[model samples]
Target: MAARNSAPEKRPGLISQIKTLLKFTKDVYPWLPWVLIGIIVAGIALGVGLGFLIPPVALWSIILWGVTGLMLGFLAAMITMSRLATKAMYAKIDGMPGATGYVITSGLGRGWHADETPVGVNPKTQDAVYRAIGRAGILIVGEGAEGRLSRLINEEKMRAKRVAPQVPVHVMYVGNGEGQVSIKALGKTVKALPKSISKATQAAVIKRMDSMTQGMASLPIPKGIDPTKVRAPRPR
Candidate 1:
């Protein structure tokens, strides 16, 4: 049986991350030149804004503008990159057996505990519920066709409530159909939930859930797709 460790993978250095991020920008937006131009213009504008606050001396002005422009440019790149990556990645994994779980788990950032594998999966419908513990209490991300997850959601909720009945168990559905959240906004949407627990409580929840699900089998990723490399640039 495969191990079920859920630690966040180590990220490469900032330089390497920037390269990967920029490469993604290029791949997803073929109009690379336009993006560069836009960022450059934005950068220059930011630099000009800062120049007003600083002295008019040539040396200081030059340095300040250079730094400001660079930072703004990188900021623009990261924002655009994340949006494009979200669209591309979600489009690729949408409607897959465990895509909702995959997207939710991968995109969650710090201050939360998330597992890439589903904590509860329905054999008949291929529905899966991915779990995360954070300031918002326990969240169950239900991924399947819209309106088809009542049974799975109820079962998973019961399982979660059985262990920690006091903790809130919120369910989020992922799909293009009505009443479902879009994949592109999955991470942001989850993070926006009201905080219901403290850091200590969140950790306790994770520890308890860990013990309960440690031996559970992993949910399957669809064939021929690599979730880790899904954000990588594709061949032209």
Candidate 2:
């Protein structure tokens, strides 16, 4: 018998990834290309201008500076694209139930331990509360009307407080309503909370909370957007 042949799976190349990202971003933001071009140009001009300030500028130095500027311009463009891509993603998922959980699960940077599945959810209204533990202590993020989520948020808050009496518990609501955080800003808001607990304390709180909430019945979250497909590329 002939030996079986197999082909290895291929991941998208960097260039391909950039192209896909550009297309995705462009769909949501029509002026993305122009904005990126302008940002890149500005970055290049700034980098080359700084290079000219160096002592004893020569032809070689000018060429090197030009190259450096070009690289910096690309880097700036990438960063800008990443941010815009994130905004576009949030816009796509905004107002959908469980968006808060999706964002928390995607990431809130390092040192964050978030429960992607909401700890408290209202099946009737699709309101929910998500929890996260970090140096900032406990974050309780709620999606749904503030009035409707008040009791749910309070219950989750009380439960967290019971598990970790000393740990700080912060609450935030995600929506377009007054005083609610936008989906795009949810991660930033969570990360910006004042650090009130040490790493050890954070770990302890997470442990206690996990053990306490373990085996609790999960509520049915409204299905719509897939969190996996809603992720934005991170900036290098």
Candidate 3:
């Protein structure tokens, strides 16, 4: 009980976390000097105009200016980081296998889980597999080489059956290779799972897997490899 309470206590304050993230991005690439410049200019201009119109609103006009400046700065920071994050994701996974799966799991919200499955072929067949077990059923996706991913996906289905035998399982091969689903179509693929599995079954499956997976230590990440860089690729 104490440990569970401590977990919640340890979560960072929301505003502080957002500020910390903004600072970290500024530390990383320093990619948006111009955006910051524009923000300062715009904030100053807006604050000056507003000050002239609403004389009594701000006790000290300078304080209002500073507040306005911070708001504009934050907005600018958001735009810069959003674009950089997208480009960084592409750069990180360009030559790696299972890249699409990374994008889906990271970009999508809850009810979806993903992991790398390097079943065969480092140069081609490595796959990023994803699963969503919901009111519908279990939807599995393998994104990588088309030819080998099918077999790998089938094996995963068999494994899931052993884990939760009653859950209906559906699979898709996410790739442009023959008889495969393309990367961009991943969300649509998942949205199509049959509404066969019940809410109770989904909850049971998650509980069972959570218990089974507990107490295992996470693998150490490779040197100089950012977590973002390993997005869709399975470890080789």
Candidate 4:
């Protein structure tokens, strides 16, 4: 008998991936197709203009430049589509509860340890606090009205302080209101924090904090939206 073959499944082809991305972005951004076309046209124009400035405009030179322009145009369009798709995804989930949790888990890049589950929640008000530990130490993000989120944020901060006394704990709320960070800016804000802890220290802090909250009851994520199903494509 032939030996059993074990191979990883192939990822979707590039054309298929682009189609999926285009469909998703178009749904959220109605003007995406036109915007992409404009970007591609501009890129091609720039490339061809550069070619014309370099030497005598021969037929071969024009063809070469035109092909180069077309390739560059597509490249620029793909990049713009990727960024717009990301923004559109965030906009789609902006006002939903647990959106912060979703961003924390999926939006933030590597070197950050965070869970999609909020560490503190107010069942009555549906307000919650999510936590993340990185080189910046601890980040506590609250979702809901600032007033209702205060208690939850405070409680989570205190828990972090108690578990890792030396580690710094930063708090911020997610919303369009005063003193709150918008969902689009959440990842940027977290990444901007000064790195105050080493990788070893970050690991220790996370382990200690996890142990402290291990026994606490896990709360159900707010209803009306499923964040896991809505993911932004990772940028190249």
lDDT of all the models against the reference?
0.73, 0.83, 0.57, 0.85
TM-score of each: 0.68, 0.79, 0.56, 0.88
- Taking the tens digit of each residue's C-alpha lDDT, what string does model 3 give over 1-236? 44554444465665665555444445445655566667767777777677767767565885686578668766766666656544544554543455554555565456654443222222333344555556666667665555556665777578678888888777777656676765555566666655676667788887765564454443222123344534322111
Instruction: State the local distance difference test value for candidate 4.
Output: 0.85
- Name the best candidate (by TM-score): 4
Sort the predicted structures by lDDT, highest score first.
Answer: 4, 2, 1, 3
Over the stretch 28-59, how does candidate 1's per-residue lDDT look in tens digits?
56786577668877887778667766778476
lDDT of 4 by residue, 1-236 (tens): 99877888877777777888888889899898998889788877876787788788776777788778888888888988998888888888898888888889877788899988889888888888899999999999988888888778888888888888899999998999888899999999899999999999999988888887788887778764587567754433
Q: Who is ahead in TM-score, 1 or 4?
A: 4
True-vs-predicted CA distance for residue 142, candidate 1, Å: 1.1
Full-model lDDT, candidate 3: 0.57
Distance from true location, Cα of 158 in model 1, Å: 0.8
Candidate 1 vs candidate 3: which has greater TM-score? Answer: 1
Model 1: ten consecutive residues of lowest lDDT: 227-236
**Residue 101, candidate 3: how far off, in angstroms?**
5.9
Tens digit per residue, CA lDDT, model 2, 1-236: 98777878887778888987888788799999998889778877776777688856776777787778888889888988988897788888999877888888775976899866888888888888888889998899888888998999999988987888888888888888888899988888887788888999988888898888876876565566678777655532
Write down the RMSD of all candidates, one decimal each: 6.8, 4.0, 7.9, 2.9
